[model samples]
Target: MTAGDELSDATAEYITANDIEHVQIVGGTGAVSADVASALTTLGVDTVARVEGDSAAAVSVALAGLANDGCGDDLGLVSSDRVALVRGNPDGVVAAAVLASSLAGGYLVTPLVVGDTLPAWVRGCLAATPRNIGADRLNLGVVAVGGTAAVSEATMEAAPDAASSTDALTVRIGAATDTSRDGAINADDPVRPDTATAGTATAISATASPATGPVLSLCFSDAVTATDNVDRVRDVVEVNGIAAVVVNAAGNAGSVCDQSRIDVTLGQTLSAGDVISVDGSSIKLGTSADQRSFGSATATVTAPARDRVRPTISIVGIAGAATARSTFEIAFGDNVALAGTALLANDEVRIVGGPGGTSPAPAVSVAHEPGASAAVATVSRPLRPGDRLIVDPGAVEDGSGNQSAGTSGSAIRAQASPRINQVLMSDLKHTAHATWTVPTGSVAGVGGTGAGITIRAKGDGDAAGAAGNGWSMVFDRASTYSADKPLDIGVSVDPKGKRVTVRFNNGPATATLGDLIAALNGDDKFAALFSAGSPAALWRLPTMRPVLCWAWSRLATWLRASATPVAPSSPSR
Candidate 1:
């Protein structure tokens, strides 16, 4: 019976009358039941022949096998090389069955089931068999039938080799090779991958360290993956031939493929001097149609050496005078520049130590001229006295791209400036003791003995009752009480005018009676020259009145006495 669960009496009678001897079963057990077979056997039918397949595609392939085999050329006319590919779903398979069989009347057409990627089995079948023309490569064409999406682009790619190598594979949308909406097709530049076993490596570079995380870049001459994919650097590439030990496929290492460029992060930290080499064969460019191994064809650069030596600063300064805040200057001993776009001013410079030093000073920005030494930085807040500055190990680089070794500078102040507090005897004699704290900063650069002030001019007020008879101190370096409004600050003994002049510094218009008394007593020179009733004393000079007296805490005073109040070992810290 052509198709029936139960045969009609006429068909049975005809079968019996004709004395059918050999009955053949088609379409497997699903189409013809055992009962029917038994019935056939009972009807004296023997030597039953059956034809079936594991799946619809398999059955179609079997049908193709049974058809007349012929050598198909690149012509549109059908022959044996036609392949019928279906979607992986069951419905897609059953639906495409009729199209596979008809093929303008059962011409040898291959049927295949494929999903996301091209089926490996199909590639194996095609690559193993050469074209009927005996050519190593065949020109193939795909006539997509039924609804569109019947076969994937990858499957169509396999079609050219087996069907018509030079013909463009037709892309379809809705249904039928004819009248169906067309999908994108690049006739000028087909989807054919290059014949090279692997892509070529254009160049390789190493950035030992930068504001951004360190990375090694290996760029390729072709697209490696279907999309952008970045993972462990050691994945596609295995580091080799380098000075240091580098593991392959390290879980910690990372890499990304952005088309042709492969940015990599090695498992190990790259230091000042590292020679890196990537294995040429280890690169995963892509495999051939037959699932063969793939690697880079050639590497433009291998074993690129890392930066040598750390950067050093020649001149490092922060407005030490407390006059300048939020700004500092540093000049590298060698030609220097900032490195990496990822660098933030805050990342490059870290304020270490105190109120300003240890605090998280939000750096606004850092500006620098290429090859210039100093880089100016602006901060959100003002920099404090204890705020010390240091360079990040990798932020600053020399002309050669070597990273900075990292360094810390002293407090932002000129010289070891001191804050003094003294007490007087009130005996009208220059006899007093002083105490001061000298914060770390500034060396003995054109100033007092680092933190010491030398006493000059000796002897007490003259007994002759002159106005300026007392030995007085002179200003080593003239200074001002303030920068905004100029207030002269210094002490001088004018013997020609018979007067001792002193301009108080730092604050207030002038020195007071107590302040003058304290200065004279605080100095060893004043104590020796006008100690209670020594030659001439402040109270004993009836005709002489106290003159200008500048009290110095940090400033240096020139006098005849060789003694100083305080001596700080560290001029600057």
Candidate 2:
């Protein structure tokens, strides 16, 4: 009897007393030994014997003895499920009991067996501790019966009425209006009350007259449920401007009449602010009044018609240029100049007959000389029909070449002069002999006794002189020539002497003396001598002068004498 045996005995006793369904002995030395197994068999308990370590033969002999009571099969025996333990040492019995029980319902009890060698039942018990026993109940079908005693005590303390019976109070909402009662006055149809306080009401049976007239009749039962001491009854009635008084209850006064009864008559139609009340309590029918006017009207306005006139036109000057010719051209109608023929100085000539009433003025051109009565040469070309022309009176030119005005007789004169002697000598000898002087010099073929012989002289020789040879003899002596050369000669006599000049062989020669002077004064050979100065000399001609001077001098003098001047006519007043 060691502690291990004691533990095993205690476990077996507890299991047998509680009738546990399974008992497992795990890890013990020896088998249940023959005696322990016999004991369990005698007690009529089924046992499973298991062997461990090198004691299987001995365990088998004990199991055989224990088998005599039919416990070998009924009380089962076996080696370890471990092959090594079963083969090497199988002497010990580690036993477990499997009683009748539901696997789904029962718990497992596994006992610890202290030994190095274990039987199969002990090893199976060790394995079955985790496998067969449930960690928690598989089905929680049973109601839990667990609770602490103090929890019941606490519940009893919290609810003192738990042992008592309950009763209820019944309150009906809006129930008063649902029923009628005797001696209850009807003030009006009752509106639903907002809250359930002790007592506030308007009696539902009341009636008041319609609001159309000035007098309203309110009727109510004499009895009311109001608890206030003053007991004022208000009739919210719409009425006209009539005063109403309370009538006697039940329509009876005294034998004749009652002082509590009153009548009403309306003065005007009812409006806002009319009310009826028994005391301080009153009904406000309405607050605001509708407004109206006796006579009202509206008028619509319309705009007036527009009267627009087109622009007009005029001419600025009569016999002068227009102020604005360009402006007038665009504003005028076709053939506008003919239409504006009456346009005078400063006359406003309005153009007419166009699409709109507007028309343009005709452009006019006028000609006038400034400040002169002479017929003004209106130098402007005449305008063709319908042509616009402008004439500026201020812009005028005179025949005297003045732009503004000139003297009436003002005329241009030719200032050149012409004379025969002024003609060049060479021109007279060659081209214009009638108007010019002949060359005064020797002729080429004539023979000469003096400087050269003159083939032609101005005059014959003069009278004789004192020495018995006449003056003519000396003149002849000077003028005599032999035929060695020919010459051309000219003679001019003055108070100083006579000069006889000869032209010979294209060279000029001169001889001067008294006899040649007298001969030149006789005027037989030359025509006449005109004196240019006081000495009275004749002009000579040069043989080689240019020809143009002779022709121009004669033509100039003839033209000057034959020219005529024309006078201009006066302007009209």
Q: Residues 247-293, candidate 2, lDDT per residue (tens digit)?
A: 21111122111111111222233222333333212311100211111
Best by lDDT: 1
Candidate 1 lDDT by residue in tens digits, 1-573? 443465557767888899877665654677666667677777787766665666544544444443434223321334444455666445344645464457636543555555555555555444433322232122233454445466666667665554322222111111011110111111111111112232222222232222222334443322233222233234444323443222211111111112223444334443322334444443233212211123332122222234475656532434446465665555554322345333325667765544535345545456766555466655556655665567767666655667767676644455565533222122232222111112111111112222222121222333111222443333232343342332223444444543333444432222122223334444453344332111111122223222323534343443222112222211110
**Alpha carbon lDDT of each predicted model:** 0.38, 0.23
Report the C-alpha displacement of residue 382, candidate 1, in angstroms: 85
Candidate 2: clashing residue pairs, number:
49
Can you give the lDDT of residue 55 in candidate 1?
52
Query: What ranges in model 2 sit over 4 Å off?
Result: 1-378, 382-437, 440-518, 521-573
Error of 2 at 430 (Å): 23
Cα TM-score per model:
0.21, 0.11
